[model samples]
Target: MSDVKKIATRDSYGAALVELGKEHDNVVVLDADLAAATKTCVFKKTFPERHIDCGIAEQNMIVAAAGLSTMGLVPFASSFAMFAAGRAFEQVRNSVGYPHLNVKIGATHGGISVGEDGASHQCCEDFALMRSIPGMVVLCPADDVEARAAMKAAYEHEGPVYLRFGRLAIPVFHDEENFHFEIGRGEVLRKGSDVALISTGLMTAEALAAADELAQAGIHARVINLCSIKPLDEELVLKAARECGRIVTCEEHSVIGGLGEAVCAAVAEAGVACRVKRVGVNDEFGHSGPAKEVLAQFGLDAAGIVRAAKSLLG
Candidate 1:
């Protein structure tokens, strides 16, 4: 196998914001005193007047971002996933979502991927929080190309959008021209009949690997790159559930109220029957360690995905 070329979605977000700033003068970026770590430092350096540091107050940052958006400025707020959705949820709900403000919450360091920072810094419940909001849009791009597209799309899209990304470098599966994205659409990566591996974010890559592994074992698996967690592609999900006898959902988020839960709800509502399994972070806190080790320990790695697939097969 070739060496896995990985790129962090946070890096892609930083680059995309800089490009957006250069192309559109009204695009502003705000950070909660984590410009360097969150990769908003590049934006701050490029557009000094447009970048605002809220000094560790994520809640205040959300309010300020909503205020900026209300004034017809496209504000992309930067912070860790936990702080953006976990801490500033009320501000996002009332100030941004309620008013339908065009504020982009560029949440980084999602799920167990923000290893060594421990459980507090790692946000496993962000999707659950954001999806519950009435008017908020929940998005989690699978790779660098998708991340760039999502950033650009969020700027063009109206209403409050929550874009979740990770801190660690992950395998980049999509190229610039290969795949395109829509707000509520999912992409079919591979086609098969026996089973379907549906996933989003960092776990998408792992699901792809698991599919390849299953192929070697004479099992044909279809792979679906499901980036938009909320407002999920119910039609596509149900079709997959009907076509494939077994369904497996992969995400770096928690097993509860995340991609897995979203898919399950869709399947249940659609009256689809299939052997469904979920691969992701369990209901447990994280610990400070290397990213790979943390993923393995938390059963969020490729091996975990393969195990899930095997169980579904049985």
Candidate 2:
């Protein structure tokens, strides 16, 4: 992956906004004084009139987006994940989720990937918070291609959307032209029967690498990229559980209420005879470090996925 073309999903989010802005006159962007960090500044640079800076007020920004949505404008509220999802959870739920507005929350710097930003800035519980909201669509894209495509999809989606993008530049594994993306649909990168490696966001890259390692160890693994978290692709998950009989769920977020928990609920509800293991940040706060080192320290990397898979297989 080091040799592969790397791109941060936040960068993709900003670029996608510019593209959407060009195509739709009703498209507008609002940032909580983090345009540069969240990459929404790129959209601001191109369309200054359409970009609104709420001056570090994440909750106010979310409410404003909700208001703008009523005016027939597609408003994207941009901020750090901690502020957008954690701090503004109340406003998002009451204003956007309650009304089912067509507002998009572009939450960047999600999970432990915030690295040196430390625990306060890292938002590991965003999925749980956002998923709890009725009619809220949660999406965590894997790479640059999917992030841009997700931005387009979020713009088109009728109800509220929460998109969590990463700060770290991860491997650009998917081809832009060849890949196809749909909401509530999981993409299978590799197929095997020994175990299913399920993951979302940047962890999908790690899962792909882990599948290769598992193959070397004679434990063929199936790699499923679950980008849509809330409306999870339960069919693909059930199929994997039925075929592989073992599942390893991974994410950059906490294992409690993210991809892991979603898969567990799906498998349990389907009554599949499968063993599921979760590989992610333990229910703990993150400390300051380089992004890659922090992820490895928390066992959110390829080796961690392989370890969990092997344990489940054994």
Per TM-score, the best of the predicted structures is 2
Q: What's the lDDT for residue 252 in model 2?
A: 87
What local lDDT score does residue 182 receive in model 1, on the 0 to 100 scale? 88
Stretches of model 1 off by over 4 angstroms after superposition? none
Candidate 2, residues 1-314, lDDT tens digits: the string is: 45899999999999999999999999999998889999999999999999999997888899999999999999999999999999999999999999999999999999999999799999999998999999889999999999999998888889899999999999999998898888899999998999999999999999999989988999899999999997999999999999999999999888888889989999999899999999888888898899889999988999999989988867
lDDT score of residue 241 within candidate 1: 95
lDDT of 1 by residue, 70-119 (tens): 78899999999999999998988888888888899999999887988898
Scored against the true structure, residue 230 in model 1 reaches a CA lDDT of 75
Give the clashing pairs for model 2. Answer: none
Off by over 4 Å in 2: none
